[model samples]
Target chain A: MPEEVILQAQRELPDWDGQGFSLLETPFSGVKFKRLLGRTRDTLRELLKIPDHFHILFMHGGASAQFSLVPLNLLGDSKCAAYVDSGYWSRKAIHEAHRYCQVEHAAIAEDYIHTSTNTAYCHITSNETADGLQLSLALKASTPLIVDMTSDFLVRPIDFEPIGLIYAGAQKNIGPAGLTIVIVRDDLLGRAHALTPTVLNYTYQVEAGSLVNTPLTYSIYLANLVFQWIGHQGGITSMAKRSQTRSAMIYDVIDASEGFYRCDIPPDQRSRMNLCFKLPDEPLTQLFIDHAAWSGLVNLKGHVQKGGIRASLYNAMPDAGVVALADFMHRFRKQYADL
Target chain B: MPEEVILQAQRELPDWDGQGFSLLETPFSGVKFKRLLGRTRDTLRELLKIPDHFHILFMHGGASAQFSLVPLNLLGDSKCAAYVDSGYWSRKAIHEAHRYCQVEHAAIAEDYIHTSTNTAYCHITSNETADGLQLSLALKASTPLIVDMTSDFLVRPIDFEPIGLIYAGAQKNIGPAGLTIVIVRDDLLGRAHALTPTVLNYTYQVEAGSLVNTPLTYSIYLANLVFQWIGHQGGITSMAKRSQTRSAMIYDVIDASEGFYRCDIPPDQRSRMNLCFKLPDEPLTQLFIDHAAWSGLVNLKGHVQKGGIRASLYNAMPDAGVVALADFMHRFRKQYADL
Candidate 1:
């Protein structure tokens, strides 16, 4: 989503690697495609500091696919798993897991950690996009932790020691929507259920080096550019700092608005990726959205499930964009306070 | 894969619809993205002449994923489906279907039709890429026919009345690799197995209008462009004519080679999309491949399973490419015939 990535892709769209053909025209088996795949994996490993024991897979079907795949692949002989009830995404994972195994619902992260040790794995949605909440604590537990990092991946350094697997849909902060990135520990490779679809089988995919089927080659190519851009912009540490500053700029205005603007989420649990808040009334919320769009700030409407204002500051968002949003928020609060 | 599509996409990569953001950065819910999805579906429906009773679903994970999905969705209560074992792709579809239902393996197209009427459905791969064989017969059967038309999808007009469903991976004649196109009858919507992964559940996808989970927006966008290109090139009729002309140029050389070059597929069954052949020996085959690449006609190597020389002339292949390959083939045969 970076400008450099898009511009470079545009420049090379017609001829990739001087091959005299569009990259879309070539199959994944082409030498240049193979090299591009290797470079993408290498750059991702460097950016995430992925351990050698982990397999980084570029797959299709996004994070929703992984909700089913996690339980199907990791359940092993144990028919039970623990899933934290964080928000909408967590509920989806839990709902899908029920069709495969017995799912124990844990109200919080600590409850999942204290879940019966006999469970196969514990699951959490590290950042809930709809509810605008994020788990801020680092988890260490005997059971492998499987995190849906779809909304927060690549925004900060990760501690992968206790993670059995982490899957992120690339659309949020990585690259495109069709591609999903899965990093799984070596120990969790081959315990898929007998009926697991081959395209969703972790062992089958890893054995074929993630070429069991045709992958989203163009999406992966874009992701490779994104990984490089992140590296050039000082890696995950800088991403984390920018996210903090950007979210704080908007959150500071909401906090200073007293009762006019409200963010019900506890400050510690507020999502840095999606900051959801409510205006004084429905009319005011519509007015804010219309005025923001007039000022060239769009897509600020809240998710349908939660009807209020939601501001998402992903890695691609410029600091100036966030500053402009914050300034508009201050002006709107001042103008409407007495009305 | 058309030059026009690539060029147009490159032009819009940075500022899609003048939205000041890359298409890759927008979620499927964005107004522009929803419009793109609508336009893609409309273009596809128009290009394919899909019937009013059929639902066109854009999905992820390609036709390979649909192998399992077909059986899972259409088996109903019969739990038995007949699959024609045409070649590599057919065998794969059968193997995956075996996991979900009782698979009746038929050696050819007629065998599937003669299969018990009680069978749930019948499946076939209309074009086998590895064997360079195409099913040219028009099928009319009481049992619903499901075709894997991955390689020949957009090359010709399709008869959809007999088909319960037809799925194609977009890599070959359609657009890109990550997106799959599924056209299924209205009656085939809701029989998916209880355990079908939500992502692969056809009924769920249709209900959500293929927005069940962020459908591959960028690939679909590219496909829309490709559809427009096909329309501009005079629709499927012109594509079919071009394919015939292009393939005959190569096949004519092989037929005239006096055993110097051989294509074993019966002339009636030879694929217009992929023309597979061989030279007298392995060294000669390698020589042919090298010379073809040197002449700027690349990807002439056959699939590993069949191992000779395979020249795929999909919809995007210009007449010049096939002509160049044919001319090179003729010269190569003449130069090496006596050796």
Candidate 2:
């Protein structure tokens, strides 16, 4: 959502790179598109600092699809995979993995922690968007590690040595919604089940250069623009620093609110990307949401299942936006403190 | 590809519906996104004249994924599925189907003729984009019929009564590449194999409102604009007429060229969307492609497997483009006649 990226896309909507036709008008297999695809992959590789041994796959179906794909691809001879049920997204991954193989919940909830196991692989949700929980542990497992970094991918730099696979839906830190970025170690390519769909097979996808079919060309193009934007913003290191500064602003407000606003998760497990909190009651929460919306701040409502309020501090969210939210929260508490 | 749609999208890229955020900046599960999703589906339903009994699914992974999905979903108790090997896409569909069930090649190549079979379903590529072959036969089968309408999905009206399911990747006549439109009869739901991935399962997709995960929101939004564009162009009947007229212009040029150019597919089975033909040799073909590119008519190169020229005349392609192509072809033949 960077202004430059949006303006570039708008300017190139009818014609791409002076090509006389839009990017959407190009054939997926054409030389021009192949170059675009290569440029996109190269830019992403540079941005993520992906090791040469890892295959960066541009796939569809979002990170939700990877919940099944991970098990289907990595759970070859083993009958079970170890999973840490941190919160909402981890639970969804666990549920989906059950269709492919038996999943062992190594730990659950606030007490959830990853441990080495004899299972095929260990899966963890790096950040849970719904419950505002995140795995900040220095996770070590005997088996390969699969991380669903849907909410906080590329928000910070991490060591790729211990991770066998990393998948993220590109809606949050990455780019758009439809595209899924799967970074898999080359050693794990041909381990998919025989019945796994061809498009979902890591080996086939890598061989096809993610052009197994006409890929989400426009989405990938937008993702490339996002990658460039990230580069301009000093890459992941700068993004991480900004993320901490922004999240701390609102968390500081919540901490000093004198029981007015409460964040349930322990500080160590709280997600920097999505902060979820509660007011005293449902009516108060509704009023908080309405007031926020009236002040031109929208999408601040909490997940219906877990009522309260939630604020997403993604990489694209500016520090000023977070400061505004903090200021509004302080004002609202003063206005309703006597109630 | 319409100017109005692209301009509207460009205008809305920075702020959507007067909201102080871009559509890409909105949460997929938010109310604004839900409304956008509903509007897209409603527009598609109105454009395609989809029946109430059909569950329209907006999915990812494109038409190639459905090559595996159809067999995985519909081939429950039946060990075999009937498939007409029309051309490139049908063969790919069959190859994928072989992973799930025994595929009975009802017919192959020019001998392809649809017949009733006691299998799970009869699959066919309605228009083969590569070989420029199409199934013009009024297909009837004892089992359900699954059609891959990738290239020419909405080029003409289709009868929904006999067809059990219809899937089209959105890159062609629809919109962009990330989205796939699946129109499934209600009875086809809940019949998927237990091992089928949740995202690929029709029942799950329908139940989830195609929000099983964050879908290709931007692609779906563009597709909705394309549907509106089609409606403004007098709907499918008008589109069919235009397609015929445009394709006829090119076919007429080929017919009058004597031996200079040739289209092999029989007239009845030729695809109106993709017009494929060959010049005398590789050099001539290369020359033709270069000349076409010089004239701002790019992406006219044929599929490498089919070693010829293919001009895709999708619904978005205007009449003037086709006329220009025909005029160019005539001039190229005249200029190269001596060689």
Best-matching candidate per lDDT: 1
* Candidate 2 lDDT, A1-339, residue by residue in tens: 676777788788787887777887667877888888899899988877999999989998899889888988898788989988888888889999888888787863353345445588888888988898888646666667789997898788867877889999998877778799999999988888998899889889999899777788888888888898999999988998888888888899999999899999999888899999999888999999999988877789887777789999987776777888999999999999789
Quote the positional error of residue A111 for candidate 2 in Å: 12
Query: How well docked is model 2, in DockQ terms?
Result: 0.77
lDDT of 1 at B224: 87
- Candidate 1, residues B213-305: lDDT per residue as tens digits? 888988888888889899999998899888988988889998988988899999988999989998899999998889878888888899998
Q: Per-prediction DockQ, in order?
A: 0.81, 0.77
Which 10-residue window of candidate 2 chain A scores lowest in summed lDDT?
A: A108-117
- The window of 10 residues in a row where model 1 chain B has the poorest summed lDDT is B106-115
In model 2, the clashing pairs are none
